[model samples]
Target: MTKLSPETILQHACIGVMGLDNNGIIQYINPRAQELLVCDTHNGISLDTIAPQIWKQVKTLIQQGMNEQAIHIQGPRGGIEMVVSPVDKKAKTSSDNFNGVVCFLRSHEKFESSAWQYPTIKEMHLQFQSLLDHSYYGIYIIDGNGIVLRVNDVAAGLIGMTKEEMVGMPIGELAEKGIVDQALSPAILKSKKPLTRPLYVVKSNKYIMASGMPIFDKKGDIRFVVVIEHDMTIVKELRDQLKHARQVADTIKNELSDRNLLELKSHEVIADSPAMNQLLTVLLKLAKMDASNILITGESGTGKGFLSKFVHQNGSRKDKPFISINCAALPDMLLEAELFGYEKGAFTGASNTGKAGLFELANNGTIFLDEIGDMPFPIQAKLLKCLDDGEIRRLGGTKSIKVDCIVIAATNHNLEKQVQQKKFRQDLYFRLNIFPVHIPPLRERREDILKICDFYLKRYNKAYNQKKRFSEKCIEQLQGYHFPGNVRELKNIIKNAVVIKENNVLDTVLPPGKNKAVPISPPCEETAAPPASKGLNEEILAFEREKLTQALNHCTSTRILADYLGVSQSTVVRKLKRHGLSVE
Candidate 1:
């Protein structure tokens, strides 16, 4: 018999694994289980005798050659989720003859408490009190009878009720009493199913967003309903701000009508550091090549989207279409339709005429998938197919459409870490990891901070028609700031500073002394005054080399050094080569 490839390595995994023959006799047991169960498969043991609750599900999955869902089984050592798939090394057909079952077990020690019994209110509270208390989202729970079994402090405070006052009160009674708005706990109880949201409750003039799920018993009967609620006070305020913004939106819209939005939106990267200079140089090189799939990784608001557009505009496909989509902005179904396009009548609300997808529209150009990490698993699989065959099959379409396009994906997520946790696919990660570029955070590339700040300052001044300027002390203070939000944050700070102040020197907003605690690095002098030890030219060259050496430790690549030195990247390369400097 052939050894299951994954199972051989999974054999030593901490989670127990067991194999059963077609006749329900144990043929193999991994080391973890051997120690736990105190038995070897040499002595055939029936799984039915060991875990009667799980054997039924296992037997069905093995016979069918696959299982779509994991089966959670409770045992002496808490609970373990079992995933079963057919072990076939050579079969080409989807149907594989089942010789034996290889079952992988995943431990669920903490989750076990929830999977098991909901004994008494006190026990329930004891089992989950710590979790509920520590969670930022308010937690409320009800029993099958709709009796409020538990309400954490956060939940109680949201409704102006104490745990004692809320407990034992039927949710229906509470809803009728109008203590808070109607709860979704009742819907979960009525349907005996999980629910995502409930009608907003108006208590203390605050709208509460609530969602819950119904827990079940061994017999699959409704046992308890747990809901998490969040106060949307700040969110409502932001919404109000949006409404006010719309009041002046028309003036801005009319102003933009005569201007090229893309041209206006386009921002030139400010590279006054080695890190950024090298990045810009490489970006241009990649743009010229224009065929390879590129992945840009960075923190949010670090100009990843901007860099991608820059690449497309500079590329061979500059005249062609450039399409972009945020993978996270739409739901899975909508995102899929938007990317691959769906045929007319494909679903209940699909377009009358099949709409062309971004991939098709971006043919011969570039398609930017922003926040690609949030893409749905199904879409990821389809994208892999498209990348492989250079053809995409629209939803409910029989024919595949060929597309010649550059795929550039950007994300703030650690895709490699996501793959390890099984949240992301390893194959897809490897495909995207090819030609990877990581944009450094603004804090790390501090040399570029002032340049970016000044760019935004000048632009905002032009837009607002105010000639406000930052004092030298203000610049120094800004440089000292950690700028945790990076360039994006710096831009906002500059805009706010200019708008709130009308004076020529908008310095007092930050207060020069506020950032004194953070050490300012010698006032960021690009070039120092000539020393008397040698002639001016020699002193300047010596100073330039010293700056390069100092920046070399902070800047990893030639591009960064070039940006830091305020020179063309080629010049930095030539200088480095002359100085016998080399990098991997």
Candidate 2:
């Protein structure tokens, strides 16, 4: 006999051979298999992509760790036959040790002529014994006669019976005996197709999401039905919790409606622009009737914290405490302890007496979580639990304390992007984002600039006992500059202009990093004639550097400065480099 390599033997083999990993992803397909499958290149592709109909049955068999069985099918090319067998890695033939599968493919004509031996009764029983290894989902295999051929431990327990008791019993008997609320096998056999429904077992008092798939014989008659069930106990609990939360919200809204609400001042919400006016209208309604959680997002200094308090002070919790905490201010341990409270001996240097957390103190009120995007990952889970269960447990505490408070979280960071990057939890984001409010940056609403300036200017003048006012040039400069710090920065500019300068008509404010004030013309201001000594290009370059330098004061990064300058980040970088300037 001549020495034959495995590759050479595979190439010369009469039947097709294909290998698939546990996930049903094609690991390798011999040339013969590719020819039969009508695919020249089939490696590294999913088995489902090649043969969706056959893939489902093959998957079920792999999950069941059944014996090799020939599956006849009709493909696009012609009649085909596939025999799937699970490959066990360990010496013990069990599903837990099965890592992959080896498939044998052939034409239906050849398969019918061949005398392939079927698995014996002992071999079938040994293969069925591996069903107990699957712990995640309940699995059941009922034959065409509706008699249970195999039952995993999980499925047996779900029906309040032993595996041996469940095996050989007709599925219809389980329903008649009141072992299960209903059986999926009966419907699957009738439909001869896959179906999923919630199965309620009266014996265990558990709800299971049952999905049954039927396997058909060559004659198109149903051969077996595989039922896979997932436990829905947690889902049911979550739904109940959500219902309770809604009820609590309704109670709070009713309470607020019954009481007299305070009239809000116009200056408190500054909405001269249509965008602000629209946002304020929504906020007012949310504060009055809706008790849902709120999420306020904006750049830093855009008054997210102020809006959060505005909602609290104007809502049903107006008479109650309004506690606020910066999530990013404290270390991880301290933040958790502060938010959820801690036992006296929870950690080293602990308080002699156990402390009440912000959540406990803010009961029946609102707790504002600022910079929520910066919250630690481990703490996010606890926060989610509190929002869901309406309770919180102190560190090192045995019992969970009841705390009911509307959580309003604020973040300047792009939470969606952070979620994609796995830095923020998607569930927590969705929970706090029940009622979203975004405060547009001040530069976006230029009309509001003068209104805000007039309001703050008069207030600052009264506070300082001065009647100073902004000159025409000063007003123009304020409107033209990009307010990177939003309303907060604009207010400070007006205040500084009123209090610091001796001139009654302030023409210029002191620029950042300069002791002396610098005159800043608005973008719309007519260009001043350049000195005769300077060329046009030189003058334009100089003007660009000056604007870039001033914008850099309010911005910490090139990305922000680019947005303010209305230019691409690359353009900003190139300009900065040309002018010998950087963000720092």
- The sequence of per-residue lDDT tens digits that candidate 2 reaches over residues 1-584 is 99999989988899999998878889889987888877776678997887788778778877776776778777667788888777763423455667788999888777655533445645665666665555588998999989999888888887789989988989988778887787678988988989999978888888889999999999999999988888897899899999999999999975664332223434455657888767766777898774757999887667888888888877888899899987865569989999999999999988979899999999999899988988999999999999999999999898999998878899878899899999999999899899989988876777888888888888989999998877787777777776656776777777777878898888876356432322442221013333465587788888999999999999887768866775434346657877888887
TM-scores for the candidates: 0.43, 0.44
Measured on C-alpha atoms, candidate 1 has an lDDT of: 0.74
Tens-digit lDDT track for model 1 on 1-584? 96668767766677677777766778777887654444454538797777666778777765555633487776666666776655552431333466666677666764365556656755876767788887788898888899988788888887777889988988886577776666577778888877775344555666678888889999988888888889786787888999889867977875563243234333676767788767766777788787568999886557788889888987889999999887865568888889999899888898899888899999998999987887878889999889889999889888999999999999877899888888778888888778889888776778987788778889988999889888887788777776545566677678778888868897654534555625532211123222356587677777777777887887777666655654434346556655666443
Minimum summed lDDT over a 10-residue window in model 1 is located at 521-530
Q: How accurate locally is residue 132 in candidate 2, as Cα lDDT from 0 to 100?
A: 50
Q: Model 2, which residues run further than 4 Å from truth?
A: 1-263, 510-584
Error of 2 at 222 (Å): 65
Show model 1 residue runs off by greater than 4 Å. 1-267, 508-584
What's the CA error at residue 4 for candidate 2, in Å? 99
- Whole-model Cα lDDT per candidate? 0.74, 0.80
